[model samples]
Target: MGLIKTVGLTKTYNGTNAVDGIDLSIKEGVCTALLGPNGAGKTTTLNMLTGLINATSGTISFDDRYMGDRRKYIGYLPQYPKFYGWMTGEEYIIFSGQLAGLTKKEALSRSDELLSLVGLSEDKKKRVSGYSGGMKQRLGIAQSLIHSPKLLILDEPVSALDPIGRREVLELMKTLKEKTSILFSTHVLHDAEEICEEIFIIKKGKLIIEGDLVELQRKYQKPTIYLNTEEPIEDWSTTIKQKEWLRHMDVKKNKITVTVEDMDMAREALLTDESLRKLKINSFEVAKTTLEDLFMEVTGK
Candidate 1:
């Protein structure tokens, strides 16, 4: 059985369903991405999984046991993790460890190690108010992990950070996944692609897609050849449309995309045909459909 499983998980507010019946199974030691746009019930689902909020109906089971309280097995970091501005990063983490039932000495030892793990060692002694947004998020991760829980849940872990901060946190998450089972929600598809082994996409509170990345890409393969020109070739339309293998074509402002049934056959045809070589080719690429394409198709936004 999966380490975490939600059977017909549902949540409602004010007589309306925010999260409809959705089932999720998280494999042990795998990084799972919970992807959805704003108001897609990602937060509500996460809160229910962590036992922070009650589910109107359905069941959440951990290790085949439905623990009324899941805090003992879960470490959660919300989108915005509040900290005591007066407290140092070190003090806060130690305090968090203690609250999780660690002894004072154990908390001290764990706090120091966790600070280093999240790249907060340098700023551990400084008041949290003096830290940057990235530091705070990293500190939040450290605090959540204080108890060494079986599962880690993060909501929009990098969404609130600047580009640099985002990169830093994503890198940390990538490394942390090796040590713990991670389930993080993000609108950023690239983050999921970068770190997650499995993806669960939700749209309008319903699951739209759930699969391994490579398997999904291969299943929905759209082999396309993209050619860009520095200067527009007037006969571009006439040149490419003649090919029998062309399934369809999209002409943008600076580029032309040709979809085909066979990528290798199309690429060979484009390269060997001397008549089309006169065009000033700026960039060319042959690729399959991306996660973004699937996301746009499923989300429609």
Candidate 2:
């Protein structure tokens, strides 16, 4: 059985469906990235799965058991987690372990282990309020893992982090995937592209795309050819559009951008075109489509 599965999950607010029938399956030991723009229902879906909010309809199961029966087997790190400002990082983690049903001794030991795992062992005595955003996120991760859950749910895990902090958190998440199934939601396409094996894209409260990262890119990614020329062709835009194989073309400054369905054919045509050759083309290269491009194409903006 999958580590986590949701069937026809739905949530409604004031007669508007906020999360509409999202069906997802997360495999064990793999990282699944839930991607979408704001108000795409990513958070709402996570909320329902973590029991923060009840789903209006649908069923959720983890490790072959209903989520209600497997609550302890799941760990959740919410976006913008609120902790007691007075509690030290160690104390906060220990408290979480206790809530997960650990004995006092077990909680203390687990707290130490998790703090070290998140690179906060030296600052265990520091109050949570004194920690930076990145440190707090690390502490939140530690608290979530205290119970040793089989599945971890993280909402916008690196949304507010700077580049260095983002790199650290993403690396930590990658390491964690060895033992636990991770399902993280993020608006950052680059982060998803970097770490996710499988991805599900939500739009306007509905599941629109879901697949392995490579397959999705291969299927939807358009082939774009960029040309740098010294002299502009008088009717460059019109000439490129005359080619039926070219889907679209954009010319700006000394560069001509061409979108085509058949990359090989496009290359051949560009090589043979006398007008392009006469324009003193300085350089030409194919541009691979990125996750951001895919998202923009799918969402139509």
Candidate 3:
């Protein structure tokens, strides 16, 4: 029994299923990433999970330990979180706490603790409109956690930020995970790879793949060769595209990446090939598949 489990969870809009029958087991105290491309139903699934919308069918079951209103046990941050820009950071959190049913004293105490947790204690008095993009997001996180929910759900937590803001929110998430369970949706494969212990990948409103991050990487591992040459290898690449061991090949101006079924055979064949030897090779290296590769493969992108 994980922290939350869904059985044939689904949602339909005008007879079209935005989220098809999908089953998920989100573990307690672990960081999980819900991943997919645009219009792949990531948001719809999160909406259903957070109870923002009613599902057309299926069941969402929390662990037996958590009883009563599902909202009480879950905290959420939307992709585009809105805050009262006129309110100071501290005031906003305290307001959110009160909205979640805390007393004035309790909200005040929690606001102080959460302000420090998100690293905004010094700037807590500053209006949200004056804060940076990263600061706003950190504040949104604090507001979400004010009620002390067991699971935190964020929809595209870092998608709209600049590089610095993205890094800031990502670092905060890494720290927050140590204190509570997290489920976030993201299209950025690198960010998901950075923090998530488990991943669920969806495509076309369907659950395509779900598993432990390390285990999925190991399972999809493939032999690949990367080649950089002083000159373009376009002509030469086309000749070997039909090789028995070649699974896939991507050719750029002066670089070629080849995915192969057999590393031993690919190494021997490429090293000794007449056309390949003719080029002034800068570097040739063999490597394993990455999470990006897995995403590309599963999503057929």
RMSD (CA, Å), each prediction: 3.5, 2.5, 1.8
Any residue pairs clashing in model 2, and if so which?
Answer: none
Off by over 4 Å in 2: 65-68, 228-235, 250-256, 271-283
lDDT of 2: 0.87
List candidate 1 segments past 4 Å from native. Answer: 65-68, 227-256, 263-285
Q: Candidate 1 — what's its lDDT? A: 0.87
Between which residue pairs do clashes occur in model 3? none
lDDT of candidate 2 over 127-246, digit per residue (tens): 999988888899999988987888899999999898877987998998898888899999878889999899999988889899898888788778888889889754665766767689
Candidate 1 structure quality by residue, lDDT tens digits, 80-175: 788999999999998999899999999999999999999989889999999988889999999999988889999999999999899889999988
Query: How does each model score on TM-score?
Result: 0.84, 0.89, 0.93
- The global C-alpha lDDT for each of the candidates, from Candidate 1 onward, is 0.87, 0.87, 0.93
Candidate 1 lowest-lDDT run of ten: 231-240
* Highest-scoring model, TM-score: 3
TM-score of 3: 0.93
